[model samples]
Target chain A: MQKVFGRPKGLTEIPFHYCPGCTHGIIHRLIGEVLEELNIIEDTIGVAPVGCAGFSLDFFSCDFVGAAHGRAQAVATGIKRALPDRIVFTYQGDGDIAAIGTSHAIHVAARGEKITSIMVNNAIYGMTGGQMAPTTLTGQVTTTSPYGRDNGVAGFPLDLPKAIATFDGAVYVASVSVDSPKNILQAKKAIKKAFRVQQAGLGFALVSILSTCPTNWGMSPVDSLKWLQEKMIPVYQMGEIKVAEEVKGL
Target chain B: MSKVLLKGNEAIAEAAMRAGCKLFFGYPITPSTEIIEYLAKHLPEAGGTVLQAECEVAAINMCFGAAAAGARVMTASSSPGISLKQEGISYLAANELPVVIVNINRTGPGLGGLGPTQSDYFQSTRGGGHGDYRLIVLAPSKAQELYDLTMEAFDLADKYRNPVLILADGFLGQMMEPVLLKEKKEGNLPPKDWQTDGCKGRAKRKIASYFLVNELAEEACQRWQAKYDQIKEAEQRWESFYADDAEYLLVGYGTCGRIAKSVVLNARKQGMKLGLIRPITLWPFPVKAFTSHFDGIKGIVTVELNAGQMIEDVKLAVNCRVPVHLYKRQGGMLPHEREILKFVGQVFNLPVRGEA
Candidate 1:
């Protein structure tokens, strides 16, 4: 008997601590596999943001620095600057990257820091319950926006990858999804390409993956996938949003 | 061993370089801006890196990143800027990463003037950020002490795996004085066993402050607290002047300490039996130094550039064994030597004239 699939070498044996039906595990697996496929697991330094993504330090078998909320890009910049030869990446959640760390996102891109960032966007803050996040869909219901996200009051959902793609320093800006097997494979490809971009010392690279928080969204695992496809895919422009001609072949 | 005249800020920058600090990240703030400016021009020539961060918040966090990557890093700012850096400093302290932070103390409560003040004694001594942590605060009185203490600060930070702050005032930072700079001390650091450089063929490492599990978090907190306790015992430094047979003790630090020394000199010449105790390490508070002089002192007068913040620590050290007094000049104003001397004479009921 042959086992066609096994745990990626980038992931540790420890089980993830995410809530049931959460897609964080899927995104983590994709990233872990990407790290292994890129042959960067040994030379990588990961920065984990505060929130559910913060536990990435324990799940990845690489050097990790747990950063303060929204400071993942800043920390990643520091680590990458200090050790230019080492590959550095930051794993962050929507709340960690978009809500509180928006300035870091804009500035890190503007400066074109040579590091990789993976933002798991679930449209809600999962670690602190179903709170409204920067990517919370318009008219969507969450704990913070109980009456549904009113664009008039809460403002419209931020299409971050599209916004980031405008920055010249962001050589590779990808908005991916892990809602299906095909999308999962595409997510892995984007994640791998992001790391490869870092390996080549290209400017900043970011892969924002549309993930699902089933426990927070009051949906089953199957329905969460359906909701992400039906709702999120329409809002956030999917596929590679930005690719510098310098790394177009990569 | 030739002495060179340098501003206090530049002296700290040079001394840091001499101590093998190769990374400096900072934002410009008054009085402390020269440190970053000097590093920007010189660190590149010394095969180091200097980054002008967007803000103090980013600068301190960058220090955390550089320090975690096994670089001797530093950041400098003034009072308002230091306030902006508190969050990152808390993270550094909690993670037990070593870095140097220089606070050229300026007047504050709100964006105050760019004059010297000791108002941040509480902010530096008592943890400025949110957490159960302590920064090893070194208060330097002059350019020479600033250079010496900046060099010592790097070693102390690495030794304890904690942040060390050089707490200076605006006057000390802006003033220029002759200092005998030491030769570059290379190869003094031990290998950083816990740096997050890479995990290839080695056990994985984490630079983090979070412990989600209840018992593990409690245990980690206890371990960090134990480190603070050990630091307090091993690093309480102070200097005493003319205290062998003195009756009055003038307690001060930074610029105030230098001022108190002059008061001691003039009062002793007038047969006033006064002495000075200058706390070099502000965090450990040098309680033992205060206790040692409690036996013969009639009073402890704390002279500060703020509204009597360190006076509380002095009173705590005295424990009512002797009368404790405070002479303060608030909001960037400095206390004159004669004013401190007059306050000392009144505390001891001595003659107000120079004949005391």
Candidate 2:
């Protein structure tokens, strides 16, 4: 008998608390698989932010520190500075990274802290019952913006990866997706490269994953993936936003 | 150990490094920026690291992260900057992470002036941050005590797994005096068995302050309260001078404490029986130390740089046993020794030195 598929060794037996159709499960699996494949699971510290992503403290087998809302980058900066030999990563939601934590995000990249950050952009605040997010599209309707987001009043959706790519300190910046098997595989590759960038002692590395919030989006799990592909892929500008010459070789 | 003339802020930084603190995260602010600058130059050579964070908010969160990893971590800021750090401070308290926070307080109700003021007494002593939590607060009046208390702060923080604050004023931060710094601690201190280094051979551990279950959250709260109770019992620190056979007792802390001491000495020379009770540890309040001297004391005067914050605590300690008067200034004005003596003279109905 051949064993083909099983849970990654980096994940725990505890069941995920994410919504049934949430893409968080897929993204979590990709990260777990990457950790296992890198054989650095035991040497890594994961910082989990306050959101649906905050629950990652329980999901990862590696040591975890839970951060207050939007402060995961600052927390990760501390861990990496203290233990430079160990790998550090932060898992943050769009609201946690792009909204209240905007200053931390910009400065963390500016300071060139040698850590990895994964921004799960579901375009809406999932944990807080679908409030409008900084990444919400202009015409998107949310709990806070029931009449649809007005570009003039609410401002345009932030293109974070593109903005981050301009920072010289951020050596690697990639906007990935997990809408399908192919995109999931691509997301894993980007995540692994980001970790490798840290191992090489390069500057900051960020991988933004376009995730789906099925329950909050009022769509089926299957339809949520479709919405992400049809609606999000056009707006987010997928693929590598920036890669330094040193990082490109990796 | 040899004595060195160092400013209060530099002495604090040096003392922290000598006490085995290896990680310092801070943002630049007046009267306290020297601590960051000193550490940035010296900490890396000592095999530690100093990170200039994006802001005070980020600096404290950085401390939270490093402390969770079982490192001796710290952050220094002034009043306005400390206000920005309150959110992260509350989070650190909730997680029960041991870290040292230094508040070189300046005048503030908003972004007030950069001068010496004890305006942050209530903020520091009354759980400055949100939620129900207490930080071990130490008030040092001089550079020597600043060095000594900074060392003690690290041990106290680790001993109880709680945040310990060194509440100083801008004057204390800027003043220069001889200080005997401890030798750098060799090898490692006790193992932080609870640190989230890695779960290589053991079950995964999480350093988190959140508990969704109601009973679990209540248990966590009880745990923090129990620790605070133990600290309050074992860690009350104060100094009483001329308190024996004295009819009047003057109470103060930090810069005001030092000023009050001179007033007591001047009053005594003029044949007015006066004593001074200085609280070294502000959080524990030194209530027992102050109340014990109330037997024959006719009145107690609390001198402060704030309007009347510490007077409330003094009254509570005295429990109406004697009159508690407030001699105070605000907005960065230092209460002079002469002015304090005049106020004490008025409180006791004594003959004034200048009165004909």
Candidate 3:
């Protein structure tokens, strides 16, 4: 009998505090595995945003700095600039990256800040009792959108990966999903490549992961995955949306 | 080794470089814009990074990251821009990161004017951001003091593992004066054992301000309060000019203090018993400066460029031992020396002085 699988060295011994049926745990595990696989765990610094994503500070076995809401990109830019040899990344949620932090997100990409960003898109504000987020579907019902999100007043959901892919500084941009086993593996691959982009000193790389928030969506673990597959995958353009010639070599 | 003429903002930037500052992130704002301009021109040549952030908010957050990565970092702005940085400043305070923030204040409740004013005294001393924390505020009244105190701010920040603010007004920021450049001395600072550069050969480090448990948050607050208490005890700084055996005392800080000193000199020449107490550390308020000079002190007057903000601290320091008077000019107006002399003469019921 041999050990087929176990916890990755990139993760700490503490268990995650994510709610059951939530996809954040899976995303964290994928990042952990990527860090271990790259062998850059010790050379990496991570910035955590102010949401459920902020809890990743305790989960990752790397140097971490927690940033104010939506400021993760700016913070990561600082760390990357100060210690250019060290790899830096930011873990932000849709609400944190696409809403209040929109300015930093756009400018960080425009500056080509040679860092990786993992945007976890769960459609709604997970930690804040399911408020309407910028990534929420137009007709989706959230706590703040009691009557369902209306494009007239609240605006439609933002396709951020497509938007980011247009920037010249963004050398690699991928939209991923984790609803199924096959998709999970693809998400991990995209995440690893994103980190490799940073290792190669390429421009900014981002992997936008469409995650599930079962508690906020009022669905079971199984049902939330189904909902994400049926609703989010079609709306957000999936797979490598943009890849620069330099990133193709990686 | 030699004295050179420099603007206050430029001198502060040069001094920060001498103090081992390796990164500067700032946004250009009136009066304080020269700081970022000077750094952008010189810092890169000195093997440092000077970034102009998207906004003041982003600049301060960049400082947060650089400081957490164990780099000596600084960011500067004026009143409006400083207000935009309040959120990041609060996070820096809670995380106990050592960074330098310079606020070259202009008149403002909101975009009032670019003229020199000390209206930001309450904002600086009372913790402009949210949370139960305090920033060590250093007030420099001259270009020379700007250079000296900017270097001192980095040491104070590193020593206490806290943010230090250099609070000056536009008057000092734009004014040119001769500054004697001193050789950088090695400060006995504690090792940055907790920086987040890398985890190689050591345990992983996390720099954060969030405490999920209520009791843990309270404990963090207690720790911060203890640190602030120690700072208040050891860091109270002030300069006294002719305060001894004077019947009238004038209190001020920054540019107002510089002007008040001249008022003291002119009043003394007229045989009027006058003195000046200029606080170098505005947060600590220099309460000890008032403990001894109360034998014949009839009145204490605070000369300010704002509407009597520091007078509150002056009143607290005096403990009502004598009446505290306020002679202020708001909306970017400077309190002229002659007008102050007239106000003092009226308040104390003394004879009119020369040139008034």
Q: Of the candidates shown, which would achieve the greatest lDDT relative to the real structure?
A: 3
Clashes (backbone N, CA, C under 3 Å), per candidate, total 0, 0, 0
Tens digits of per-residue lDDT for model 1, A1-250: 9999999988999999888888889988888888888888889999999998778799998899999898888888788888999999999998988988888898789889999999999999998988999999999999999999999999999888888889989999999998889988999989999999989998999999999999999999899989999999999999999999987988
TM-score of chain B of each: 0.97, 0.96, 0.98
Off by over 4 Å in 3: B354-356
Residue range with the least summed lDDT across 10 consecutive positions in model 3 chain A: A102-111
lDDT of 2 by residue, A1-250 (tens): 9999999988988899999989888888988998999998888999999989878888988999999999999999888888888999999999999998988889888888899999999999999899999999888999999999999899999989898888889999999999888888999999999999998999999999999998899999899988999998999878989899999888
DockQ pick, better of 2 and 3: 3
Best by DockQ: 3
* Tens-place lDDT digits, model 3, residues A169-246: 999999999999999999999999999999999899999999999999999999999999998888899999999998
Go through the candidates in order and give each one's C-alpha lDDT.
0.90, 0.90, 0.93
Best by TM-score: 3
**Proportion of the native interface contacts kept in model 1:** 0.75
For all candidates, state DockQ relative to the true structure.
0.81, 0.82, 0.89
Please give the TM-score that candidate 3 achieves against the real structure. Answer: 0.99
lDDT of 2 by residue, B230-265 (tens): 988899999898988789898988898888888888
Pitting candidate 1 against candidate 3, the one with the higher DockQ is 3
The worst-scoring run of ten residues by lDDT in candidate 1 chain B lies at B183-192
